[model samples]
Target: MLPLIPYALALPLLWATGPTAPDSLIIFNASRTYHYQAIFISPAGDTLSRERITMQPSGQPWVGQPKRQTACTIQYRYNPGDSLTFAARPNPQNQPGRQPQAYEWRKSTVTGVIENPQEIWMHPIRSNQYAYTEVAPFPQVRPADLHPGGSWQANRLFIMGGWGAFKGSVRPFYQVKAPATRRYGNQNLAGCWLIESVGQHSRLGNSYLDFYFHPRYGFTEMHYRFYDGTQISLVLEGLPTGNK
Candidate 1:
Protein backbone atom coordinates (compact mmCIF):
# COMPACT_ATOMS: atom_id res chain seq x y z
CA MET A 1 0.00 0.00 0.00
CA LEU A 2 1.14 3.56 -0.67
CA PRO A 3 1.76 5.81 2.33
CA LEU A 4 -0.90 8.47 2.94
CA ILE A 5 0.05 12.09 2.42
CA PRO A 6 -1.80 14.93 4.13
CA TYR A 7 -3.53 17.55 1.97
CA ALA A 8 -0.84 19.98 3.10
CA LEU A 9 2.09 18.14 1.43
CA ALA A 10 0.28 16.73 -1.63
CA LEU A 11 -0.42 19.98 -3.45
CA PRO A 12 3.26 20.99 -3.53
CA LEU A 13 4.52 17.61 -4.81
CA LEU A 14 1.91 17.47 -7.61
CA TRP A 15 2.97 20.96 -8.54
CA ALA A 16 6.68 20.03 -8.72
CA THR A 17 6.99 16.54 -10.27
CA GLY A 18 5.14 13.40 -11.36
CA PRO A 19 6.49 9.80 -11.38
CA THR A 20 8.80 8.64 -14.18
CA ALA A 21 7.92 5.21 -15.66
CA PRO A 22 10.74 2.65 -15.25
CA ASP A 23 11.68 -0.13 -17.72
CA SER A 24 10.78 -3.00 -15.39
CA LEU A 25 7.07 -2.72 -14.59
CA ILE A 26 4.14 -4.98 -13.71
CA ILE A 27 0.53 -4.20 -14.64
CA PHE A 28 -2.35 -5.83 -12.76
CA ASN A 29 -5.79 -6.73 -14.19
CA ALA A 30 -8.12 -3.77 -13.91
CA SER A 31 -11.24 -2.22 -15.42
CA ARG A 32 -10.82 -0.31 -18.70
CA THR A 33 -9.34 3.16 -18.27
CA TYR A 34 -7.85 2.30 -14.85
CA HIS A 35 -4.72 4.41 -14.24
CA TYR A 36 -2.49 4.51 -11.14
CA GLN A 37 1.21 5.18 -10.48
CA ALA A 38 3.91 5.10 -7.77
CA ILE A 39 7.67 5.81 -7.45
CA PHE A 40 10.22 4.05 -5.21
CA ILE A 41 13.98 3.58 -4.82
CA SER A 42 15.63 0.17 -4.53
CA PRO A 43 19.26 -1.20 -4.69
CA ALA A 44 19.26 -0.68 -8.48
CA GLY A 45 18.15 2.92 -7.98
CA ASP A 46 14.52 4.09 -8.52
CA THR A 47 11.55 2.19 -9.90
CA LEU A 48 8.07 3.41 -10.76
CA SER A 49 4.90 1.31 -10.20
CA ARG A 50 1.63 1.64 -12.07
CA GLU A 51 -1.64 -0.32 -12.17
CA ARG A 52 -5.18 -0.03 -13.50
CA ILE A 53 -7.52 -0.67 -10.56
CA THR A 54 -10.86 -2.20 -11.54
CA MET A 55 -14.31 -2.03 -9.96
CA GLN A 56 -17.47 -4.06 -10.66
CA PRO A 57 -19.67 -1.86 -12.84
CA SER A 58 -23.22 -0.89 -11.94
CA GLY A 59 -26.48 -2.75 -13.01
CA GLN A 60 -26.89 -5.92 -10.89
CA PRO A 61 -28.58 -5.57 -7.53
CA TRP A 62 -30.14 -8.93 -6.53
CA VAL A 63 -27.22 -11.33 -6.19
CA GLY A 64 -23.90 -10.74 -4.45
CA GLN A 65 -21.47 -8.22 -5.92
CA PRO A 66 -17.83 -7.35 -5.26
CA LYS A 67 -15.59 -4.46 -6.32
CA ARG A 68 -12.12 -4.96 -7.86
CA GLN A 69 -8.97 -3.78 -6.10
CA THR A 70 -5.33 -4.81 -5.50
CA ALA A 71 -3.04 -5.29 -2.53
CA CYS A 72 0.76 -5.77 -2.76
CA THR A 73 3.84 -4.24 -1.23
CA ILE A 74 6.50 -2.43 -3.27
CA GLN A 75 10.00 -3.23 -1.94
CA TYR A 76 12.25 -0.19 -1.72
CA ARG A 77 15.20 1.02 0.38
CA TYR A 78 14.21 3.55 3.05
CA ASN A 79 15.37 7.14 2.82
CA PRO A 80 14.23 10.38 4.48
CA GLY A 81 13.05 13.25 2.24
CA ASP A 82 12.37 10.69 -0.51
CA SER A 83 8.92 11.16 -2.04
CA LEU A 84 6.68 8.71 -3.87
CA THR A 85 3.35 9.14 -5.72
CA PHE A 86 0.48 6.77 -4.87
CA ALA A 87 -2.05 7.79 -7.50
CA ALA A 88 -4.95 5.55 -8.51
CA ARG A 89 -6.07 4.52 -12.02
CA PRO A 90 -8.53 6.74 -13.89
CA ASN A 91 -12.34 6.50 -13.81
CA PRO A 92 -13.46 3.41 -15.67
CA GLN A 93 -16.56 3.56 -13.48
CA ASN A 94 -17.28 6.86 -15.16
CA GLN A 95 -19.33 6.62 -18.34
CA PRO A 96 -21.90 8.82 -20.10
CA GLY A 97 -24.93 9.43 -17.86
CA ARG A 98 -23.07 7.69 -15.01
CA GLN A 99 -21.10 9.92 -12.66
CA PRO A 100 -18.65 11.76 -14.93
CA GLN A 101 -15.72 11.24 -12.56
CA ALA A 102 -14.50 8.58 -10.15
CA TYR A 103 -14.23 9.72 -6.58
CA GLU A 104 -12.13 6.68 -5.64
CA TRP A 105 -9.38 7.74 -8.03
CA ARG A 106 -6.76 9.28 -5.73
CA LYS A 107 -3.18 10.49 -5.66
CA SER A 108 -0.97 10.66 -2.58
CA THR A 109 2.72 11.19 -1.79
CA VAL A 110 4.64 8.96 0.60
CA THR A 111 7.57 10.53 2.43
CA GLY A 112 9.74 8.79 5.03
CA VAL A 113 9.52 10.17 8.51
CA ILE A 114 11.84 9.83 11.52
CA GLU A 115 9.07 9.75 14.15
CA ASN A 116 5.68 8.37 13.16
CA PRO A 117 3.15 11.11 12.52
CA GLN A 118 0.71 11.97 15.31
CA GLU A 119 -3.04 11.15 15.00
CA ILE A 120 -5.96 12.53 17.00
CA TRP A 121 -9.72 12.17 16.51
CA MET A 122 -11.93 15.26 16.67
CA HIS A 123 -15.04 13.53 18.12
CA PRO A 124 -14.69 11.50 21.31
CA ILE A 125 -18.14 9.99 21.97
CA ARG A 126 -19.71 6.88 20.44
CA SER A 127 -23.36 6.62 19.15
CA ASN A 128 -24.39 3.06 20.01
CA GLN A 129 -25.17 3.59 23.67
CA TYR A 130 -25.10 0.66 26.12
CA ALA A 131 -24.12 0.34 29.76
CA TYR A 132 -24.01 -3.20 31.12
CA THR A 133 -21.64 -5.43 33.07
CA GLU A 134 -20.43 -8.69 31.56
CA VAL A 135 -17.56 -11.02 32.41
CA ALA A 136 -14.68 -10.28 30.01
CA PRO A 137 -12.11 -12.89 28.92
CA PHE A 138 -8.42 -12.88 29.78
CA PRO A 139 -5.38 -13.67 27.70
CA GLN A 140 -1.72 -14.44 28.35
CA VAL A 141 0.81 -12.50 26.29
CA ARG A 142 4.13 -10.62 26.36
CA PRO A 143 4.36 -6.93 27.33
CA ALA A 144 4.35 -5.48 23.81
CA ASP A 145 1.81 -8.15 22.95
CA LEU A 146 0.07 -7.12 26.15
CA HIS A 147 0.37 -3.57 24.90
CA PRO A 148 -1.57 -4.37 21.69
CA GLY A 149 -3.13 -7.38 23.49
CA GLY A 150 -3.86 -10.67 21.81
CA SER A 151 -2.90 -14.25 22.96
CA TRP A 152 -4.29 -14.82 26.49
CA GLN A 153 -7.35 -14.73 28.72
CA ALA A 154 -7.98 -12.20 31.49
CA ASN A 155 -11.17 -11.30 33.39
CA ARG A 156 -12.90 -7.91 32.91
CA LEU A 157 -16.06 -6.36 31.49
CA PHE A 158 -15.47 -5.12 27.91
CA ILE A 159 -17.49 -1.93 27.71
CA MET A 160 -17.61 -0.02 24.40
CA GLY A 161 -19.38 3.15 23.17
CA GLY A 162 -19.42 4.76 19.69
CA TRP A 163 -21.10 7.38 17.42
CA GLY A 164 -20.51 9.03 14.06
CA ALA A 165 -19.65 12.57 13.02
CA PHE A 166 -19.79 14.70 9.85
CA LYS A 167 -17.77 13.81 6.77
CA GLY A 168 -14.04 14.55 6.91
CA SER A 169 -14.49 15.57 10.54
CA VAL A 170 -11.88 13.35 12.20
CA ARG A 171 -10.08 10.07 11.68
CA PRO A 172 -11.16 6.70 13.18
CA PHE A 173 -9.90 5.17 16.43
CA TYR A 174 -9.35 1.51 17.41
CA GLN A 175 -7.60 -0.81 19.93
CA VAL A 176 -7.50 -4.41 21.29
CA LYS A 177 -7.12 -5.97 24.71
CA ALA A 178 -4.18 -7.92 26.15
CA PRO A 179 -4.68 -11.36 27.66
CA ALA A 180 -3.72 -12.49 31.17
CA THR A 181 -1.17 -15.09 30.09
CA ARG A 182 1.74 -13.34 28.37
CA ARG A 183 2.10 -15.14 25.01
CA TYR A 184 2.81 -14.12 21.37
CA GLY A 185 1.59 -11.57 18.81
CA ASN A 186 -1.20 -9.00 19.19
CA GLN A 187 -4.40 -10.88 18.34
CA ASN A 188 -8.25 -10.85 18.65
CA LEU A 189 -7.77 -8.85 21.80
CA ALA A 190 -7.73 -5.81 19.46
CA GLY A 191 -10.14 -3.96 17.10
CA CYS A 192 -11.03 -0.51 15.72
CA TRP A 193 -14.00 1.68 14.51
CA LEU A 194 -14.85 4.94 12.70
CA ILE A 195 -18.00 6.73 14.01
CA GLU A 196 -19.96 9.17 11.86
CA SER A 197 -23.19 10.92 12.96
CA VAL A 198 -25.31 12.48 10.21
CA GLY A 199 -28.62 14.35 10.38
CA GLN A 200 -30.09 17.79 9.70
CA HIS A 201 -30.27 20.77 12.16
CA SER A 202 -28.50 18.96 15.03
CA ARG A 203 -25.31 18.83 13.03
CA LEU A 204 -22.19 17.46 14.75
CA GLY A 205 -19.02 18.97 13.40
CA ASN A 206 -17.28 16.43 11.15
CA SER A 207 -13.98 14.51 11.54
CA TYR A 208 -12.95 12.98 14.88
CA LEU A 209 -11.38 9.66 15.89
CA ASP A 210 -9.90 8.36 19.15
CA PHE A 211 -7.07 5.88 19.75
CA TYR A 212 -6.95 3.40 22.62
CA PHE A 213 -4.80 0.53 23.96
CA HIS A 214 -5.62 -2.44 26.21
CA PRO A 215 -3.58 -4.29 28.79
CA ARG A 216 -4.73 -6.44 31.76
CA TYR A 217 -8.60 -6.00 31.47
CA GLY A 218 -11.73 -3.94 32.34
CA PHE A 219 -11.05 -0.53 30.66
CA THR A 220 -8.63 0.11 27.82
CA GLU A 221 -6.90 3.51 27.78
CA MET A 222 -8.54 6.12 25.44
CA HIS A 223 -6.27 8.26 23.27
CA TYR A 224 -7.98 11.21 21.47
CA ARG A 225 -7.66 14.97 21.46
CA PHE A 226 -10.68 17.21 20.81
CA TYR A 227 -10.70 20.61 19.11
CA ASP A 228 -12.30 22.18 22.17
CA GLY A 229 -9.10 21.39 24.05
CA THR A 230 -11.06 19.11 26.40
CA GLN A 231 -10.26 15.39 26.70
CA ILE A 232 -12.51 12.60 27.94
CA SER A 233 -12.09 8.87 28.67
CA LEU A 234 -13.91 5.82 30.03
CA VAL A 235 -13.12 2.32 31.26
CA LEU A 236 -14.71 -0.90 29.99
CA GLU A 237 -17.37 -0.72 32.70
CA GLY A 238 -19.35 -3.39 30.83
CA LEU A 239 -19.86 -4.65 27.28
CA PRO A 240 -21.41 -1.72 25.41
CA THR A 241 -23.99 -2.44 22.68
CA GLY A 242 -23.95 -2.86 18.83
CA ASN A 243 -21.75 -5.83 17.92
CA LYS A 244 -22.03 -8.36 15.12
Candidate 2:
Protein backbone atom coordinates (compact mmCIF):
# COMPACT_ATOMS: atom_id res chain seq x y z
CA MET A 1 0.00 0.00 0.00
CA LEU A 2 1.05 3.59 -0.52
CA PRO A 3 2.44 5.49 2.48
CA LEU A 4 0.10 7.51 4.69
CA ILE A 5 0.21 9.50 7.92
CA PRO A 6 3.11 11.93 7.63
CA TYR A 7 3.10 12.65 11.36
CA ALA A 8 3.63 8.99 12.42
CA LEU A 9 7.10 9.78 13.37
CA ALA A 10 12.51 10.44 14.53
CA LEU A 11 16.64 10.33 13.85
CA PRO A 12 20.12 10.37 15.41
CA LEU A 13 23.17 12.63 15.54
CA LEU A 14 26.47 12.77 17.42
CA TRP A 15 26.60 12.25 21.18
CA ALA A 16 25.89 15.42 23.10
CA THR A 17 24.28 15.09 26.51
CA GLY A 18 20.97 14.13 28.05
CA PRO A 19 18.24 15.51 25.79
CA THR A 20 14.89 16.66 27.01
CA ALA A 21 11.57 17.01 25.14
CA PRO A 22 10.40 20.58 24.63
CA ASP A 23 7.24 22.20 25.89
CA SER A 24 5.18 21.10 22.85
CA LEU A 25 5.99 19.64 19.44
CA ILE A 26 2.70 20.63 17.83
CA ILE A 27 3.33 24.32 18.39
CA PHE A 28 3.05 25.52 14.81
CA ASN A 29 1.25 28.71 13.92
CA ALA A 30 -2.38 27.86 13.19
CA SER A 31 -2.78 30.40 10.37
CA ARG A 32 0.23 29.49 8.28
CA THR A 33 1.29 26.65 5.97
CA TYR A 34 4.55 24.73 5.77
CA HIS A 35 6.30 22.44 3.31
CA TYR A 36 7.88 19.06 4.11
CA GLN A 37 9.73 16.41 2.11
CA ALA A 38 9.62 12.61 2.12
CA ILE A 39 12.32 10.29 0.82
CA PHE A 40 11.34 6.73 -0.11
CA ILE A 41 14.19 4.27 0.26
CA SER A 42 14.62 0.93 -1.48
CA PRO A 43 16.04 -2.21 0.07
CA ALA A 44 19.27 -1.52 -1.77
CA GLY A 45 19.36 1.98 -0.23
CA ASP A 46 18.45 3.77 -3.45
CA THR A 47 16.14 6.69 -3.82
CA LEU A 48 12.87 5.28 -5.02
CA SER A 49 10.55 8.30 -4.99
CA ARG A 50 10.59 11.80 -3.56
CA GLU A 51 7.72 14.20 -3.10
CA ARG A 52 7.03 17.63 -1.62
CA ILE A 53 4.05 17.64 0.74
CA THR A 54 2.28 20.75 1.96
CA MET A 55 0.76 21.22 5.41
CA GLN A 56 -1.86 23.87 5.88
CA PRO A 57 -4.10 24.43 8.88
CA SER A 58 -7.82 24.63 8.10
CA GLY A 59 -11.15 24.33 9.80
CA GLN A 60 -11.85 21.17 7.74
CA PRO A 61 -10.26 17.75 7.75
CA TRP A 62 -9.02 15.92 4.65
CA VAL A 63 -9.48 12.17 5.23
CA GLY A 64 -12.64 11.52 7.25
CA GLN A 65 -16.25 12.70 7.46
CA PRO A 66 -16.64 16.44 6.72
CA LYS A 67 -18.86 17.34 9.66
CA ARG A 68 -15.77 18.06 11.74
CA GLN A 69 -13.61 20.83 10.33
CA THR A 70 -10.49 22.91 10.92
CA ALA A 71 -7.59 20.51 10.72
CA CYS A 72 -4.11 20.86 9.28
CA THR A 73 -4.38 19.38 5.75
CA ILE A 74 -1.23 17.77 4.38
CA GLN A 75 -1.23 17.55 0.59
CA TYR A 76 0.88 15.10 -1.35
CA ARG A 77 1.98 15.47 -4.96
CA TYR A 78 2.75 11.85 -5.80
CA ASN A 79 0.68 8.62 -5.56
CA PRO A 80 -3.10 8.10 -5.59
CA GLY A 81 -3.28 8.54 -1.83
CA ASP A 82 -5.32 11.57 -0.91
CA SER A 83 -3.86 14.30 1.28
CA LEU A 84 -4.11 13.94 5.08
CA THR A 85 -5.24 16.67 7.46
CA PHE A 86 -5.13 16.32 11.27
CA ALA A 87 -5.56 18.57 14.28
CA ALA A 88 -3.69 18.71 17.58
CA ARG A 89 -5.86 18.33 20.67
CA PRO A 90 -4.29 20.17 23.56
CA ASN A 91 -3.53 18.39 26.82
CA PRO A 92 -6.41 18.09 29.26
CA GLN A 93 -4.82 20.73 31.48
CA ASN A 94 -5.41 23.38 28.79
CA GLN A 95 -2.60 25.57 30.00
CA PRO A 96 -2.72 29.17 28.85
CA GLY A 97 0.12 29.91 26.48
CA ARG A 98 1.06 30.28 22.83
CA GLN A 99 2.38 26.76 22.87
CA PRO A 100 0.09 23.98 23.98
CA GLN A 101 0.82 22.14 27.21
CA ALA A 102 0.51 18.83 25.33
CA TYR A 103 -1.34 17.65 22.30
CA GLU A 104 -2.63 14.41 20.79
CA TRP A 105 -3.46 13.85 17.16
CA ARG A 106 -7.15 14.43 16.42
CA LYS A 107 -9.42 13.56 13.50
CA SER A 108 -13.13 14.36 13.22
CA THR A 109 -15.29 11.83 11.37
CA VAL A 110 -18.93 11.14 10.69
CA THR A 111 -19.14 8.59 13.47
CA GLY A 112 -17.36 10.84 15.95
CA VAL A 113 -14.08 12.53 16.79
CA ILE A 114 -11.04 10.30 17.21
CA GLU A 115 -8.26 11.31 19.57
CA ASN A 116 -4.76 10.00 19.19
CA PRO A 117 -5.47 8.72 15.69
CA GLN A 118 -3.83 5.66 14.23
CA GLU A 119 -2.38 5.31 10.74
CA ILE A 120 -5.68 3.94 9.38
CA TRP A 121 -7.71 6.94 10.49
CA MET A 122 -6.18 9.01 7.68
CA HIS A 123 -7.42 7.57 4.35
CA PRO A 124 -5.86 7.55 0.93
CA ILE A 125 -7.87 8.52 -2.16
CA ARG A 126 -8.94 4.98 -3.05
CA SER A 127 -9.38 3.69 0.50
CA ASN A 128 -12.93 3.13 1.78
CA GLN A 129 -14.94 1.59 4.63
CA TYR A 130 -12.15 2.31 7.09
CA ALA A 131 -12.86 1.37 10.69
CA TYR A 132 -10.79 0.67 13.82
CA THR A 133 -11.05 0.00 17.57
CA GLU A 134 -8.80 1.59 20.17
CA VAL A 135 -7.77 -1.17 22.51
CA ALA A 136 -5.50 1.33 24.31
CA PRO A 137 -3.48 4.50 23.95
CA PHE A 138 0.01 4.36 22.52
CA PRO A 139 2.77 5.23 24.94
CA GLN A 140 4.44 8.62 24.49
CA VAL A 141 7.37 10.34 26.13
CA ARG A 142 6.10 12.64 28.85
CA PRO A 143 7.92 15.33 30.82
CA ALA A 144 8.33 13.10 33.88
CA ASP A 145 9.43 10.14 31.80
CA LEU A 146 12.23 11.81 29.89
CA HIS A 147 13.50 8.36 29.05
CA PRO A 148 11.09 5.77 27.63
CA GLY A 149 10.90 2.23 28.83
CA GLY A 150 10.45 -1.10 27.12
CA SER A 151 7.12 -3.00 26.67
CA TRP A 152 4.88 -0.01 25.89
CA GLN A 153 1.68 -1.33 24.24
CA ALA A 154 -1.47 -0.03 22.58
CA ASN A 155 -4.28 -2.01 20.94
CA ARG A 156 -5.98 -0.50 17.89
CA LEU A 157 -7.13 -1.01 14.30
CA PHE A 158 -4.70 -0.43 11.41
CA ILE A 159 -6.27 -0.32 7.93
CA MET A 160 -4.39 -0.34 4.67
CA GLY A 161 -6.11 -0.67 1.27
CA GLY A 162 -4.61 -4.04 0.34
CA TRP A 163 -6.68 -6.76 2.10
CA GLY A 164 -8.28 -5.37 5.26
CA ALA A 165 -7.41 -3.85 8.61
CA PHE A 166 -5.91 -5.65 11.59
CA LYS A 167 -7.47 -5.57 15.06
CA GLY A 168 -5.00 -6.48 17.80
CA SER A 169 -2.72 -5.18 20.51
CA VAL A 170 0.42 -3.34 19.38
CA ARG A 171 3.38 -3.16 21.68
CA PRO A 172 5.72 -0.36 20.53
CA PHE A 173 8.90 -0.55 22.58
CA TYR A 174 11.37 2.31 22.76
CA GLN A 175 15.14 2.56 22.90
CA VAL A 176 16.13 5.90 24.38
CA LYS A 177 19.49 6.55 22.88
CA ALA A 178 22.07 9.22 23.62
CA PRO A 179 21.45 12.76 22.43
CA ALA A 180 22.44 13.65 18.89
CA THR A 181 22.72 16.79 16.80
CA ARG A 182 20.21 16.79 13.91
CA ARG A 183 19.04 19.40 11.42
CA TYR A 184 16.39 20.28 8.84
CA GLY A 185 17.40 22.27 5.76
CA ASN A 186 20.70 23.28 7.34
CA GLN A 187 18.89 24.62 10.40
CA ASN A 188 20.09 22.79 13.50
CA LEU A 189 17.39 21.05 15.57
CA ALA A 190 17.86 21.95 19.20
CA GLY A 191 17.90 19.48 22.09
CA CYS A 192 16.80 16.50 19.97
CA TRP A 193 15.78 13.16 21.46
CA LEU A 194 16.10 10.01 19.36
CA ILE A 195 13.86 7.06 20.13
CA GLU A 196 13.69 3.85 18.12
CA SER A 197 10.88 1.33 18.14
CA VAL A 198 11.90 -2.33 18.13
CA GLY A 199 9.17 -3.43 15.71
CA GLN A 200 5.42 -3.65 15.22
CA HIS A 201 3.23 -6.55 13.97
CA SER A 202 0.83 -6.02 11.13
CA ARG A 203 -0.87 -8.33 8.62
CA LEU A 204 2.45 -8.30 6.82
CA GLY A 205 4.97 -8.72 9.62
CA ASN A 206 7.13 -6.80 12.06
CA SER A 207 8.44 -3.35 11.14
CA TYR A 208 10.13 -0.57 13.05
CA LEU A 209 9.91 3.22 13.45
CA ASP A 210 12.49 5.81 14.55
CA PHE A 211 11.23 9.07 16.03
CA TYR A 212 12.90 12.45 16.64
CA PHE A 213 11.49 15.12 18.89
CA HIS A 214 12.49 18.30 20.68
CA PRO A 215 11.14 19.25 24.08
CA ARG A 216 9.83 22.46 22.54
CA TYR A 217 9.34 21.39 18.94
CA GLY A 218 7.26 18.20 19.46
CA PHE A 219 7.02 15.20 17.00
CA THR A 220 9.80 16.37 14.71
CA GLU A 221 10.13 13.49 12.20
CA MET A 222 10.05 9.71 11.77
CA HIS A 223 11.42 6.89 9.67
CA TYR A 224 9.51 3.65 9.00
CA ARG A 225 11.35 0.57 7.81
CA PHE A 226 9.52 -2.47 6.50
CA TYR A 227 10.69 -6.04 6.82
CA ASP A 228 11.40 -6.15 3.10
CA GLY A 229 14.03 -3.47 3.79
CA THR A 230 12.04 -0.65 2.26
CA GLN A 231 12.65 2.52 4.26
CA ILE A 232 10.39 5.58 4.36
CA SER A 233 11.70 8.75 5.98
CA LEU A 234 9.75 11.94 6.69
CA VAL A 235 11.34 15.07 8.15
CA LEU A 236 10.13 18.49 9.13
CA GLU A 237 11.71 21.10 6.88
CA GLY A 238 10.58 24.30 8.55
CA LEU A 239 7.85 25.67 10.75
CA PRO A 240 5.17 27.74 9.04
CA THR A 241 5.90 31.46 8.98
CA GLY A 242 2.50 32.98 8.18
CA ASN A 243 -0.74 32.48 6.27
CA LYS A 244 1.08 33.78 3.20
Candidate with the greatest lDDT versus the true structure: 2
- Tens digit of lDDT per residue, candidate 1, span 105-141? 2222111200001111111112111000010011112
TM-scores, in order shown?
0.18, 0.53
lDDT of 2 by residue, 1-244 (tens): 3233322211111123222112111333345555667776656787655666565545334243333222455566654321221122222223334344322222322221111211111121111111111111221443433454422332233433222223323344556665567787768776677766644544445666676756544445667665556666667787545532
Tell me the lDDT of model 2 at 76. 60
- Compute the lDDT for candidate 2: 0.42
Residue 121, candidate 2: alpha-carbon lDDT:
17
TM-score of 1: 0.18
- lDDT score, candidate 1, position 30: 16
lDDT of 2 at 209: 66
Off by over 4 Å in 1: 1-125, 128-165, 169-212, 215-219, 236-244
